[model samples]
Target: MWGRRRKHRPKEYFIFGTIQEEDRVIRINPSLDQPFVPLWFLRYVLYHEMLHSVVPDETVSGGRRRVHTEEFNRRERDFPSYCRARRWEEENLARFLR
Candidate 1:
């Protein structure tokens, strides 16, 4: 599922993508569809969402559910472009916020 891009205010937090375990749906932010958005970064987002299907969430103190557990993080880092994708996001996030 490709989600429509919403207008985001500057300095606000944004979700690049998400996965719904129950519905088995992975929704990607349409902002990434731009020509300037690198394919590796897009693949990274899809990979992150796909991981949610395989990695189970963890229950922590106060009964809180942690989706990105230590194990999940470890697996996420396995992606070849993980570091580059992160750096790209950090440097270019403001462009997408528009």
Candidate 2:
């Protein structure tokens, strides 16, 4: 449940965080290291990644990998302060992109 700051990347890269299943680690974007970032938001992102560790992967009819399955979304909503975290992300996305 720890995240490390990564090198600054352009918004075009559109990368945030990634979970390495093999290593069980989360690599976070450098933009998230700003002071404006709220703890709840960080917790939300971490929780989302942690969920991936427990949720089983899904395969569609076309054999496509569904990382965020319906069940995953459902469980995500169960997180305390889910709406608040999502709203904060939507409102502060530009700052992260900067």
Candidate 3:
């Protein structure tokens, strides 16, 4: 779930993306003034959310968000070039429209 589309929208920045019980959807920030985010970076984030949707045992004990599990890391490892995607997101594009 990228986000639930309500009759009245909430703050747009908070709507970057979301994960529902069994599905994941990523809503790109259209109001973002950046020219474009590379495809691989988007795929990486989408994969991150997809992992949450696929694994049902993710549990949060308290305020901490413990969505990732050992199995989640293993699933993430299946992506051969995860490092490259992280590098692109961290080093190349960090700033965005406010």
Candidate 4:
């Protein structure tokens, strides 16, 4: 992920990573590239984005795309440090917000 200037905003929402399915490209938020950020946490975010490639999105009613399907979440939890990674995110989210 490449760093770029962004407008300051509240910490109400944040996206750790994303994937462009058509281009098969993954983009992680540059905020996660900090000294305090753990490598395992970074890997977890990457794994989540990579999962998008294998787990198909579900087409819900009205044709809305459901990116994180039940199957996707199930597989995500299969990650070795899923719980720990999530806990770390919750604890360290404020760092990225700044």
Q: For residues 1-98, could you state the per-residue lDDT of candidate 1 as single tens digits?
A: 78865665345876889888779788888877889999899899999999989999999999999999999999999999999999999999988765
Per-model root-mean-square deviation over C-alphas: 1.9, 2.3, 4.8, 1.8
- For residue 38, give model 2's deviation from the true position in Å: 0.4
Per-residue lDDT for 65 in model 4? 98
Q: Could you give the candidate ranking by TM-score, starting with the highest?
A: 1, 4, 2, 3
- lDDT tens per residue, model 2, 1-98: 33555466666545567799998798766668778888788888888888999999999889999999999999999999999998988787776665
The C-alpha stretches of model 2 lying farther than 4 A from their native spots are 1-13
Candidate 4 TM-score to native? 0.86
Task: Indicate whether candidate 1 or candidate 2 has the larger lDDT.
Answer: 1
Tens-digit lDDT string for candidate 4 (1-98)? 64354677457778888888788688888777778889999899999999999999999999999999999999999999999999999998777765
The reply for model 1, stretches above 4 Å from the true place, is 7-11
Using all chains and alpha carbons, the TM-scores for the candidates as numbered come to 0.88, 0.84, 0.58, 0.86
lDDT score at residue 49, model 1, on the 0-100 scale: 91
Cα RMSD for predicted model 3:
4.8
Ranking by lDDT: 1, 4, 2, 3
Predictions in order: lDDT: 0.88, 0.81, 0.59, 0.86
The C-alpha local distance difference test score for the whole of candidate 2 amounts to 0.81
